[model samples]
Target chain A: MLQKRIIVCLDVRDGKTTKGVKFKGNVDIGDPVLMAEEYYKQGVDELVFYDITASSEKRGIMIDIVKKVAEKIFIPFSVGGGIRTLSDMKQVILAGAEKVSVNSSAVKNPSIISEGAKHFGKQCIVVGMDVEMDFSKPSGYGIVINGGRTKVDLDALEWAKKIEKLGAGEIVLNSIDADGTKNGYEIKLTRMISESVGIPVVASGGAGTSMHLADVFNEGKADAALIASMVHIDGYTVGGIKEFLNKENIPVRI
Target chain B: MKIGILNYDAGNLKSVETALAHLGAKYFVSSDPYELAKSDKLIFPGVGEAQSSMKILKKRGLDIFLREYFKKGNPILGICLGCQIVLDSSEERNTKCVGLVPGNSKEFSHNMDLKIPHMGWNQVQSTNNHYIFKDIPNNSSFYFVHSYYPDPDNQNAVIALTDYGISFSSAFSVDNLVAVQFHPEKSGPHGLKLLDNFISKTQGV
Candidate 1:
C-alpha cells in the first residue's frame, strides 16, 4: 500500500526559508539548506521550496538554494514559483530538484505543462493551484495566481481537471483562505479537488495539528499533506506527526 | 577515486550524485568515453525517450564503448531509463538498445486502478539474495518513475520482482552488469546502502 506523505514546505526568499501569514507579513526563518536538513532529520517524507520572490530574482536564487539543499538532503525536494519555461524546469531539475511545481506560469501557458511532462516525464511536473472560495462565482471556489493576489474567473475544479489533462503528474491544492490559518486544512475544498482529479492530490495550507493531518487524509483523501507553519514553529515534528498518524492507522513514512 | 556517472543527457544525474555522496563515495559526472572507461565504476543513468537516448548514446559512441567496457567485466549499474537501454529493445519508439541484458522493454496496457508512468515508491521482493541487497530490509520500498519495464528472457537475470498491476522484473544482475527499474538514487537510506554495496563490491573490479 502507498503511504501518505508528510511534506514540509519552506517559503524561500533570497535563498532563505521564510514564513508568513496568508502570504504576507513575511519573516526570515533561516538558510534553506539548513532548514531542509532539519526537516529531513525529523523524517519528513518530502520538502517543498516555494520561491516567494519576483520573477527576475527567482532563477539564480532558486537554483542556488536547490543546489545547497540537494547537497545536504537526499529526500525528494520540489521548487515552485517563478518557474515560467521548460528551460526553467530543466534548470531546477538539473540543479537537484526532483519535481518542479508551477502555478502562474502554468496557468498563463498551459502547454508548458504538457511540454514539460513530455520532456522531463510527468512525475517531474507538479501543478500548484492557489484556490479560494468565491461565493459570487457559480462553483464557489476560484483559482488565484500571482501569489494568490489575483483571482481568475476560472473555476478551481475545472482548472484542476484541465491541468491533469495537460499532463500534470500531481496537483497541489493550496487553499488561499485556509493558508496560515493553522486551524486545520480546508477539508471540503481539498476533498472536492482530490475527488475531482484522477492523479495524486497534495493538500496544502492550514495544517495545524496531528488531527488536522488525519482529517485531511481521512476526509480529504489526499495522498499527501503539505505543512509549513506548524513544523516551522516547532509545533510538531515530522516524526511526531507521522507517529500520531501511525497510531491512528494512517499509513505514513516512519 | 571518483565513480563516473555517464551523462547521456537523460535521467536525474544529480539525484544519483546526491545518493552516492550520502554513501561517502566521491563521484564525477561525465559523458566522455575516456573519462567513463577509466573510472572505478560507471552508472549509466537515464530518463527520457528511448530512441532519443539511444541516438545520443550512439552519436557519442557510448553504446559501443559501454559494450566493450562491459566485456572487460567492469561493474556498471543502470537505473530506470538506463535499465531499459540495457535490454535488447524497447517498445518506447520501437528502438533497439544496448542489448547488454537478455530482455526487451514494453509498455503496460493492463487494466488497473494505477495510471501509466508508475510514479512514487514501491517495495522489491528479492529473488536470490544478492550482495547488492545486503543489509537492506526485505520488502523495502524504493522510488520508481517510468512508463515501460524490461521483460527479461532469462529468469535467472532477475534479482527482484515488484507488482504494479502485474509482477515485473524490478532488479536484475548478470555478471558485472546490473540494473534496477527503480531509482535507488532517489530512494532513502535503503537506496544509499545499495550504492554502498555496489561501491564496495566494485572498488577493485
Candidate 2:
C-alpha cells in the first residue's frame, strides 16, 4: 500500500528560512539545515523549499542553500519559486532537489511543462496550482498566479486535467481561499481536483492541525499533504503530526 | 572501500553521491565505465525514459561494458530504471535491455484510479535473508517512483515485494548482483543503510 506522505515545507528568503521554524521538543533548531535535519530525524517523508527571494542573485544563493540542505537531508524534496526555465530546473536538480515546481512561470508559458517533462522525465516536473474559489466559475474555483496577484481564465478542474495531459507528474493543489486561515484543508476543493485527475494530488494550504491533514487524506483522497504554517508557527513537529495521523489509520512513514 | 557510482547522466546521482559521502565511503561518479574499473563495487542508478536511456547506454558503450561487468559478477546494484535495464527487455518503447537477470520489464496494468507511476514511500517485505538488507528492519518502507516493474523469470531471485495494486517484485538479489525498483538514496535512513549494506557486504566478500 502507498503510504500517505506528510511533507514539511520551508519558506526560504535569500539564504535563510523566512520565519523561525521551531520544534517545541527539540532545541537544536536555527538554520534551514538544522531544522531540516531535525525533521529528517523524525522521519518527515519529504520536504519542500520555496525560494521566496526569487531574485537572480538570490536564486544562485538558493542553489547553495539547496546543496547544504541536500547534504543534511536524505529524503526527496522539491524546490519552487522563480524556477523559470529548463536550466533553472536543472540547477536545482543538480544541486540535489528531486523535483522542481512551477506556478506563475508555467502559467505564462505552459510549454515549460511539456518542455521540462521532456528534458527531465515527468517525475521531475510538478505543476503547482494556487486556486481560489469563485462562485462565478463553473468549477467554483479559479487559477491564481503571481502569489494570488493575478487570476487566469482557466478553471481549476480544466487546468488540472490539462497539466496531467501535458505530462506533469503531480499536481499540488493549494487553496487561496483557505490559505493561511488556520482552519483546515479545502476538502471539497481538494477532493474535486484529486478525483478529477489521474496523477497524484498533493493537497496544500489551510492546515491548522494534524486532524486537518488526516481529513485531507481520508476525505479528500490526497496522496500527500503539504504542511507549513501549522508546523512552523504552531508548536507542532513532523513526528507529532505523523503520530497523530498514524492513529487515524492514515499510513504515514513512521 | 573504493566504490564506483556509475552515472548515466540521469536520476538521483547527486543524492546518491551525497548519501555515499555521508557514509564516509570513498566513491566517484563517472559516465565512463572505465572509471569504475578500479573500484571495488558499482552502483547503477537511473531515472528517465527506458528507450532513450538505453540509447545513451549503447552510445557510451556502457551497454557492452555493463554486460561484461556483470559477467565478472563482483557486485553491482541497479536502481529503479537502472534496475529494469538489467532484465532481458522492457515493454517501454519496445526497448531491449541488458539481460543480466532472466526477466522482462512490464508496465503495471493501466489501473486508472491507482496512480500509474506508483510514487511514494511504501513497505517492502523481505522475501529471503538477502545480504543487501543485512541491517535494515523487516517490513521497512523505501521510496519508489516507477510505472514499470521487473517480472523476473526466476521468482527465487526476487528478494522483496511491495503491493501497489498487486504484489510486484520491488527488488531482486542474485549472486553478486542486487537491483531495486525503489530509490534507496531518496529513502531516508533505512535507504542509506541498504546502500551501506551493499558496500560493507560486497567488500567483506
Candidate 3:
C-alpha cells in the first residue's frame, strides 16, 4: 500500500531555519542544512524548505543552502519561495533538490507551472497554495500571494483545479488562518481540495500533535501532512509522530 | 571501477552524482557512447517523461549503446525513468523503448480511486532472492513518484512488487541488468545501501 507521508517543513530566511506564527514575526531557529539532515536521520519521510524572504525581497532561493542540504541529506526534498521562471526551477533541480515548488509566482503567471512541468517532468513540479477562509468566495476560501501579504480574488477550489490542469504534480494546501495555530489542519478545506483534484494533496500548516495528523489523514483524506512547529519547537520527534500514527492504523514509513 | 551515469537530457542528474561521490566511487556523467563504453558498469538515472527521453536517447545513439551493452551481459542499474525506458514500449507517449527487458510501461488507471502520480515512500517487497537485493530487508520502504509502472510480460523477470491501489512490479532483473522504479539515490540510508549492494554485485561479491 502507498504509505501516507510526513514531511517536515523548514522555513529558511538568510540560510537559517526560522518559524513564524501565521507568517509573522519569524524567529531564527537553526541552520537549514543541519536541521534537514537531522530530520532525515530521525526518519522523516521527506523535507520541504521554503525561502521565506525570497518572494518579498525579489531574490532567488539560496542555492548554497540547497546544495549543502542535498550533499548531507539523501532524501526527496523540495525548494520553494522566489521561484519565478523555468530557469529558477532548473537551477534548483540541478543543484540537487528533487522538486521545485512555485506558489506566489504560479499565481502571477500560471504558465510557469506548465512550462516547468514541460521542461522538467511533472513529478518535479509542486504547486503550493496559501489559502484563507472567506465566506464571500465561491469556495468559501480565497487565495493569498506574496507570502500571505496580498490576497488574490481567486477562489481556492478553482485555483487548485487550475494548477492540476496546468501540470502540477502535487498541491501543498497551506491554510493561512490555521497556520502556526497548533489547532489542526484545515480539514474542511483540505478535504474539499483533496477530493476535487486527481493529484496528491499534502495538507500543510497547523499541525500541533500526532492526533492532528491522524485527523487530517483520516478525516481530511490527505495523502500527506506537512508539519513544522510540532516537531520544530514543541519537542516532538518525527519518529515519535510516525509511531503514534502507525498505532492509529495510518500507514507511515517508520 | 569506473561507472558511467547516462546523461541524455534527464533532470536532476546531480543527485546521482552526489550519491556516487558520497560512496567514494569513481563515476562520470556522459551522453557519448565511447565514454560510457569504457565504464565497467553503467548507472542509468533518469527523471522525465518517456517520449522525450526516448527521443533524446535516439538522437544521442544512447538507445543503441544501451541495447548493445545489455546484450554483452555487463551490469547495468536503472532507476525511475531509466527503469521504464528499458522496456520495449510505454503507455506514455506510446513510446517504443530500449527493448532490453521484455515488458512495457503502463499508466495507472484513474478509475482505481488513487492519486495519478503516486509520490512519496512505500514498501517494495522482494519477490525473489536476487543478488541486487542482497542485504536489503524485505518490504523496505523506498521513495517513488510516478504514474506509470513497468509490467514485464515475463513474470520471472520481476524481482519485486509493490501495492498502490493495485499490486505492480516495482523492480525487475534480467541476468546482468537490474532496474527499479524507485529512486535509491534519494531514498536515504536504506537507499544508499541498495546502491552499495549494486556496486558490490558488479564487483562479483
Candidate 4:
C-alpha cells in the first residue's frame, strides 16, 4: 500500500525560509537549503518550497535556491509560487525539482495548469489552491490567491474538479482558516475534495500534532498531510511525528 | 570508473548528476550514442511521458543504440520511466518501448482501489542477493512516484519487490540490464548507498 506522506513546506522569500502568521506578518526563520537538508536528514517524506514573494513580486522562480536544496536532499521536492509559464516550469524542473506547483498563476491564466501539464506531464504539475470557507461560493469555500489576499469567482471544490480535469496531477488544498491556527485541519472540507478528486489531495494548514496528521489520513481520507507551524515552530520533528503516527496505527513512511 | 548518462530532455538528468557529484564520481550527460558508449557504465535516468521521450530517443538515434547496447550485456541502469522504456511496450499512450525485456509496462488498474500515481516513500524488499542491494538493509523505504510498472516476461529477472495495493517488480536485474521503478536519485541515503553498489560493481569492468 502507498504510505501516507508527511511534507515540510519551506516558505522562502529572497532565498531565506520565512514563516508568516496566516500568510501575513512573516519573519525569517532559517536558511532555505539548510532547513531543507535538516528536514531531509530527519526523514521527511517530501519537501515543498513556496517562494512566498515570487507571485506578489511578479518575477520568475528562484532557481538558485531550488538548485541548492536539490543538490543537498534526494527526495521528491516540489516548488511553487510565481511560476507563470512553461519555461518557468522547465527551468525549475531542470534545476532538480520533481514537481512545479502553480497557485496564483494557475488562477490568473487557468491555461498554465493545462499548458504546464501538457509540456512537463501531469505528474510534474501540481495545482496548489488556497481556500477560505465561504457560503457564497458553490463548494462553500472561495478560491483565494496572492497569499490568500485575492478572492476569485471559482468555488474551492468546483475549482478542484476543474484543476484535475485540466490535467493537474495533484492538489494541495490549503484551508486559509485552518492555516496558522494550530487547532487542526478542516477535515470536513478536506474529505469533500479528497473524495471528489481522483488525484492525491494534500490537506494543508492547522496541523498541530501527530494526531492531526493521523486524522487527516484516516478520517479526512487525505493521501498526504502538509504541516507547517507544528514542525516549523512548535518543536516537532519529522521523525517524532512519524514515530507518533506509526504508534497510532497510521501507515507512515517511517 | 566512468559513468555515461542518457539525457533525452528529461528532468532526472540534473538530479542524477548531483547525486553522482556527491559520490565524487566522474560522469557525463549526453545523448550521443558514441559518447555514452565510451563510459565504463551507463545510466538511463528519466522522468517524462513515454511517447515523447521515445520519439526524442529515436530522433537522436539513441533508442536503437541502447537496445543493442543492453542486448550485448553492457552495464546500464534505468530509473522510473527510464526502466519502463527498457521494456517492450508501455500502456501509457500505447507506446512501444526499447524492449530490453519481453514484458510491457502496465498501468495500475483503476479498479484496484489504489492511487493512480503511487507517490511517496514505501518499503522495498529484495527477494535475492543482487549488486544493487549490497550493503543496503532490507525493507528499506525508497521514494517512488509512478502509475505503471513493468510486467517482465521472466520472473527470475525480478530481484526486488514492493507492494502498493499490488505486488510488482520494484526493481529487476537480468544479465547486465538493471532497472528500478523507484527513483534511486531521489530516495535519500539508502538510494545513495544503492548507487554506490552499482558504482562499485563497475569498478574493474
- Candidate closest to the true structure, highest lDDT: 3
Q: lDDT score, residue B51, model 3?
A: 91
**lDDT tens digits, residue span A1-254, model 3:** 88999999998888788989977798999988878888999999889998877444434447888888888888899999888999889888888889999999999999999999998989889999999999999999999998899988899999999999999999999999999889999999999999999999999988998999999999999999999988889999999999999999999998
- Residue B151 of model 4, lDDT score: 82
lDDT of 1 at A229: 79
Candidate 2: fraction of native contacts reproduced: 0.84
lDDT tens digits, residue span A1-254, model 4:
56889999988888778898887798988888988888999999899998876444433436888888888998888998878889889888988899999999998999999998777778889999999989997778889998899988889888999998998989999999999988889999999999988889999999888888888888899998998767778999999999999898888877
Every candidate's fraction of true contacts kept comes to 0.38, 0.84, 0.94, 0.72
* Candidate 4 per-residue C-alpha lDDT over B1-205 given as tens digits, one digit per residue, 9 for 90 to 100: 7999898986557888999999988999888988987878889988778898999999999999997787667688899988899999999999998987889898888886676778778889999988899888898888887889888989999999999878999999878888999988888999999888887785324
RMSD list, candidates in order: 2.5, 3.1, 1.4, 1.8
Error of 4 at B67 (Å): 2.6
User: How well is each residue in B1-205 modelled by candidate 2, as lDDT tens digits?
Assistant: 7889887776658998999999989998888878877778889999998888888888998988888887786799999998999998999998999888889999887754688789999999999988888888888999999989988899999999998888999999767889999999999989999998987884436
Say which candidate scores most in DockQ.
3
Q: Assess each prediction's global lDDT (C-alpha) against the native.
A: 0.86, 0.87, 0.91, 0.87
Candidates 3 and 4 compared by DockQ, better number: 3
Model 1 off-target regions past 4 Å? A54-59, A135-139, B22-26, B202-205
Q: Model 1 reaches what TM-score against the true structure?
A: 0.92
Inter-residue clash pairs, candidate 1:
B11-B47
What DockQ do the predictions score, one after another? 0.47, 0.83, 0.89, 0.72
| Chain A TM-scores, candidates in order | 0.97, 0.94, 0.97, 0.96
